[model samples]
Target: MTGGPTLPALPPSLRAPLGLVAVLAALVVSVIGTLYAGHSQPGRVDRWIVSPTADPVGPPWRPVALTLDFLGEPAGSVLLVGVVVAVCLLLRRPRAAVLTVAGVALAVGTTTLLKQLVGRTIHGPDNLSYPSGHTTFFTALGLALALLATDRLGLGRTAGTSLVLCVALLAGAAMGWAEVALGAHYPTDALGGWCTALAVVPATAWLVDRAADRLESAGRPEPR
Candidate 1:
């Protein structure tokens, strides 16, 4: 989606900081929400969200449900990250590739830790369901892909970002819905997972940009 001619592209310096702050805020809210949900007694919202999907609604949604579930698995997560990294490298954006991989890894690790720490229970046998690992991985991957598309693919600031945001929201909603339908997580768990990704990906990108700038500066010749 192209913006109007009057729409100005944000400078990299400003964009990075703003994105980081927004993501951090999301992470904080997600963390607090998850903790509250875990500690509080199961309420109407939790029941209402999980009930419809507890048992399969029909045959039509089965395939989509299965696909989304699979995509959130470790193998699926790895594949998604690999594809994003490969795309970035193919675009000759090594920093993007590195940042994507690192960001995903950090997000996954943090989610795992939070799951154990929070110890949120769902209908499933697994007790560590506070934040859905699958959702976290996929969300992070989506964000990384969006960043690459905007920064490297020359898709323009507005169009590329808007496209990526739409894709990421769809992907995240699908994954979260599938998890709930399968009785693997509560709605809050999925929210927490998204929050984790929001926090990690932008922070990682900012760090990568800073590191790249430092390296570039170091490699420059000294003025005589």
Candidate 2:
């Protein structure tokens, strides 16, 4: 269902540039993924960020990390999405609700598929971890929220773009840190996951708007 005042379309001036950035971000995920494919060891880049031998997160911060990690899990993700969708509907922002679910789902799905293709393992051969799905989910969620806020506030181009990037960056960094600290993924894997969301969400938002517009147009009565 189309919501009143649909998710604000990215300003026309920003769309082309953002689209290009999305493509480049996606390529970054691909190139790094290919280099590490079928390998379990951390690469030179990963080694530069955090030692492969560092101890897992402990006591004070472990719970915090686990809490963030849990939010990325299936049950937690569902709960989070449900709440967001419910709020969107309450506010008569059904388009925002749809984008929330669709964008996050597409971003996470991209990581899942890439994991299979990249075959980058972390702890063992069976555990694929090229792009971190957890990082993607949080990043996508942040982007969706930022977009909704931007539209609701009628933010200008510079302000809106800044808000969207800042929110997504913070969300991605928070989840990425949790994943790396817990030794679930290499630093590069988290980076790839962050890029995957950056690549997917905007594109998904644009598509959702286009699809909704077309559907609404089709349902409109023709002039007499």
Candidate 1 lDDT, tens digit per residue, 1-224? 33221111222633654485556746674656555545533445677766643465457887888888887787877787788778766666777778778888998898888877776675544666767787888787877777766754456546765765676677678888887777677777777787787777777777777776777778889999
Which regions of candidate 1 deviate over 4 angstroms? 1-42, 52-54, 124-126, 153-161
Clashing pairs in 1: none
**Residues 1-224, model 2: lDDT tens digits:** 34485444454444665688689899999899889988889999899999877899999999999999999999999999998888877878877888899999999999999999989898788989989999999999988888877777777777877888899899999999999999999989999999999999889878887888898889899999
Alpha-carbon RMSD of each model: 5.4, 2.2
TM-score, cand. 1: 0.80
Where is model 2 poorest over a 10-residue stretch in terms of lDDT? 5-14
lDDT of each: 0.69, 0.87
Per-residue error (Å), model 2, residue 174:
0.3
Q: Write down the RMSD of candidate 2 (Cα, Å).
A: 2.2
